[model samples]
Target: MVKSPVPVFLFITAEAVALLANSAFLVVFPWLVLSHTGDAGKTSLMTALVTIPTAVATLLGGRVIDRIGRKPSSVLAGLGCAVAAAGFGVVSGLGALNIGTLIALGMLAQAFLPPSTTARDALMDAIASVGGISLERLAGIRQVVFSLTYAIGPALAGLLLTAISPIAAFWIIAGAWTFAALLTTGLPSGTSRKVSEAAITPSGSVWKLLRSRRAVWMAVVIGFGASVITQPITSVLLPAHFRDLHQPQLYGVSVSAFGVGAILGALLYAAVGAKAGVKLYVGGVLVTTAGIVAFALLPSFWILALGLALGGLGSGLLAPMLLVAVTRNTADNERGQALGVYNAASLGASPIGLGLLSLLLQRHPDLHAGAFAVLGVWALAAVYALTRPSVIVSTPGQQQAADTAAV
Candidate 1:
């Protein structure tokens, strides 16, 4: 152990804020756009607003994280988000908020957000290596933080919708992240050493990993499929569903159950996922699909919430395992770049999903039908994934040996 819990705690808090910002995308941000413009097109466009730039930025930003150092990247990320949030507040107050401004600011925030968060991921991995924390424990803690934020962030954003103006909530987002930046007020008090060129670049390290490591490749593929399934639902369908019902709060609250279920799932993973095999992984994906089916087939409030929670449980099981797979497959010096690549491909699918969903929402009167169609797409993608050989996960010593194996 590195002799301090402060860095780990600080890192977790910063990550929580980032996840909260994402949950905001799935909640208040959509409401802000729709409430202002009353346009589903604009609201659906919000998904692209967040994802496209994030996908592109993360792809490029992964190498940037290695080049610039982790702490600086993180600080920059927090500041970017702060500006975006504060900008929203300022524009709304000035009566100047418009789609153009929203798009520009959203791009700026997302462009910075993922790389910085990835940097933090690298930073924490380093801390764990040096801090006496096992990678499994570290991954578990991070997954828990993610799950908790997903659980609470939407609920909080929704509550804000009910209790506060979107503008005020914007300021609160700004203030929270500003505090995040101050923390340089820092993780492990800063471990942003520059990675050597060889470490940073290996003809796109993540792609190489995908080619060589079945586990990493499978994680990215499953992650991409999951991303494709989720974006439209979280960013478009559910929000639209609840707002139309004039029960917008349910959107956030129901999503919260997904997060809650994630916590349970993550805990279970911590308990046993490390040793679990392909069958368990397949089960998780199926469970996740079942949750989406609930949306396609059921519209009752409590049922939606329960189904989402069930989905969360499934997701929770897979998430930490994904992290472990990626980390186990990469060395410390190359972790950020590799993760960036993993994230880029995985998250890149999100914009595609959103774009297609946007078109569907525009053409279709029934959102549930749109959801059913999404489920069909997911089924095909899952088939593609399930057909691939299950990843041959191994113990750390064996994994490290495999990591350095020739492609």
Candidate 2:
């Protein structure tokens, strides 16, 4: 009912909050469950349960965004996430929580998050169309925000965990999600000037799109492989290795180094991406792969820091590039769905990859560095996938199809 700024900053704030709520609690919640249950399996399940529903909900969320508009779907998702977090807080205080209860609540919380995120992606795309900004520029802006969130959110979560109770962390996350809901309420109506009206000729349906989008599938594979490399460094290698060296504090420093590098990389992308074009994506992947290799081989803390930063920067470039690329093949009408599939694959693969990495660490501790090499291979595969004829933005038929689909 109320008017808002044309190029409003609310979406930015909403996006940052969404990232904070989704990621900050990731470090907080597992520990909360472990403190209560003292069961490793329970803790693991608590951690894994959220991803399943979130991934499933993401696909549906895309269609919902297309049908209902981005703002409304996002607001609904934000509200759901806030309410779930609030429920966890209430249950924790009342001593009514158990593993089953926590998992159920966590599932509900995550299911809402992907919908909110998909809507945000759609809204950003729509805004870029209205502003006459290129997709790369929009992606650069998104990269900056994501980088900042990854940099700040974990530190804030850790500080909250140490200074107060983990319950306080949940409250903080709830407040963030609630703020996203409020921000979404203020966004103006659609400014999409040229969404094509052609019916999505169900070319194989949603399942077909999921199957045929080689870039999307490659994105998932490469993302999962990268996560396998990174998660172990965060969870196992850093802490254990640093503890052995009697420099546990370096563990935190190393993690911070990765975050700072990501922020810097995203900033760099924001500055040069529109002009850099495909070079940005190509260079980023190579830098990232090299960084991962260096991280594994270099035992010194300083070198490790540099490697992590380089890799983070590389990771930062892909998001925006991939977003733009995904949208190129998608019709304006189906932008939400296409982006959802791309975003979902990117989000969905990490847990599976990380889980397998954890298993490898347990079974073949010597293969730890091998994990990084695997990521490099995957990145090369992703590069190859991006080069396929169907993925090239220069293809007229695909471009025409994309233009028609968005309406």
The candidate that achieves the highest TM-score relative to the unseen native structure: 2
| Local accuracy of candidate 1 as per-residue lDDT tens digits, 1-407 | 33676666776777777778767655766777788889999788775566567777887777788777888887887788888889998887799898887777777777777876787766766666656666666677778888777667777888888998887888888887778777744665446667777666665546665677666676777778777877787778888889889998888788778778888888877666656666667777788778878877757998888888888888887777677777776666666777787778667777788878878878886887788988888777567666743543455566556556744
Count: clashes, candidate 2? 10
Q: Check candidate 1 and list the clashing pairs.
A: 1-131, 1-132, 2-131, 183-186
Q: Supply every candidate's count of residue pairs whose N, Cα or C atoms clash at under 3 angstroms.
A: 4, 10
**lDDT tens digits, residue span 1-407, model 2:** 33334544667777888898888878877878888889989788778866679877887777776776677888888999989888888998899888777888888988888888887777776666655666567667777888778778787888888887877778888898898888778766663222333543243376566456555444545555555456656776668767867998888888887777777777777677667765666777788877777677746889878887788777777666666666655555676777677667767665655666677667677654544545555666556745642443233365455434643
The parts of candidate 1 lying over 4 Å away from their true place are: 25-51, 88-100, 161-165, 202-206, 232-257, 274-308, 354-392, 396-406
Any idea what lDDT model 2 has? 0.70
lDDT score for candidate 1 against the true structure: 0.74
Minimum summed lDDT over a 10-residue window in model 2 is located at 192-201
